[model samples]
Target: MAAENQHQVPPPPGLIASLAGLAKNCLHLLLSRLELAAIELTEVRDTLLQLSIVFAIAMLAAWFAIAFGTATLIYLCWEAMGWKILALLAGLFAVLAVALVLWGRSLVRQGKLGLSSTMAELKSDRDMLL
Candidate 1:
C-alpha cells in the first residue's frame, strides 16, 4: 500500500498552488481593507478641516461681538455701578473658559478624535489572528 501510494503521486504542486491562491486572496483582502481605511481617514480629515474653518470664523465673529457688547455694557453702567459689574463679568468669563477647557480635555481623554471604526476592525483582526 505504501509503495502504491508513493508511485501514485506527490501532492506538493497542488498543495503549493492552493496555498498561493489563498495567500493572494488574503493580500487582496488586506489591500481592500487598507483602501477603505484610507477613504474613511480622508473623509474624517476633510470634515475636521471644514468644521475647524467654520468654528474659527464663528469664534472670530463672537470675539468681536463680545468685545463690543462688553464695552458698551461697561460704559453704560459705569456711571451707576462703576467697576463692580466689570469685575463680575470678567470673573464669570474666566469660569466659563475654565469649564470649556475641562470639557475639551475630557473629550480628548475619551478618545473622541480616534479612528474608532478602523481601530475596532484592526482589533478584531488581531483577535482572529491570535
Candidate 2:
C-alpha cells in the first residue's frame, strides 16, 4: 500500500515551473492591489466632486446673504454711524483674511495633505522586500 501510494504521488515541479508559478502569482497580486487602489481613487474623486459642488453653492448663497445683511445694517445705521460701519466691516474682513492665510500656511507646513499614508506603506513594502 505504501509503495502504491508513493507511486501515485505527483513529482516535484522543476525550477522553471516553480519560477513561472511564482511570477504568475506575483502578477495576480499586483493586479489585485491595483484594482483596489483604482476603486478607492474613484470613491475619493466622487466624494471630492460632490463636496466641491455643494461648497460652491453654499458659498454663493452665504455671500449673497451676507452682502444683503451688511447693506441693510449699513442703511439702518446710515444717519448715526455714517461711514464708520463700512470701515469697521472692512477692518473685520482684513483681520479674517489674515487669520485664514495664516491657518492655511500652518496646514501646509504641517504637511497634512501630503500622501503620508501611501508613503508609509511604500516604505514598509520596500523594507520587507529589500
Candidate 3:
C-alpha cells in the first residue's frame, strides 16, 4: 500500500497556479472597467458644466436683446399709437412667454436630458455579466 501511494502522481501544479492567475486577471478587468466608468462620468459632468455656462450666457443675451427691441418698438409707435401700444405689446409678450414656458415644461417632463449613452453602456455591461 505504501509503495502504491508513493507511485501515484500528485495533482498537476498548474491547476492552483492557473486559478490564481485567473482571479488576478478578473480583478484587473474589474478595475479597468471601473476606471472607464469614472472617466465617462467625469466627461459627462464637464460637458454639462460647459453647456450650463453657455446656456446661461445665451439666456442673458437674449433677455437683453428682447428688452431693447421691445423698448425700441414701443418708442417707434409711441407717437402714432399713443400709450395703447404699450398695453398691446405687453399682452403679446406675456402670451408668448407663457407659451414658451409651457413648451419648456413639457420638454422637461419628457426627460430629454437623460444620460442615454451611459445607461446603454451600463445595460450592456449588465447583460454581459449575466
- lDDT on C-alpha atoms for all candidate structures: 0.86, 0.79, 0.83
Candidate 2 TM-score to native: 0.72
Report the C-alpha displacement of residue 66, candidate 1, in angstroms.
0.6
State in Å the error of residue 113, model 2: 7.5
Candidates sorted by TM-score, descending order?
A: 1, 2, 3
> Could you give the candidate ranking by lDDT, starting with the highest?
1, 3, 2
Comparing 2 and 3 by lDDT, which wins?
Answer: 3
The local lDDT score (0 to 100) that residue 77 gets in candidate 1 is 92
Cα lDDT for residue 69, candidate 3: 94
lDDT digits (tens) for residues 1-130 of candidate 3: 9999999989876988999997898788678667776777787789789989998999999999989998999889999998899899889989989999999799778854565555676678679768
The worst-scoring run of ten residues by lDDT in candidate 2 lies at 112-121
Model 1 C-alpha lDDT per residue in residues 12-105, reported as the tens digit of each score: 5688899999899879868977987898889889988998999899999989988998999998899999989889889989998999899979
Off by over 4 Å in 3: 1-30, 99-113
Measured against the true structure, the TM-scores of the candidates, in listed sequence, are 0.76, 0.72, 0.58
The sequence of per-residue lDDT tens digits that candidate 2 reaches over residues 14-93 is 99999999899778866766665666667767867997899799889988987998899899998999999999888987
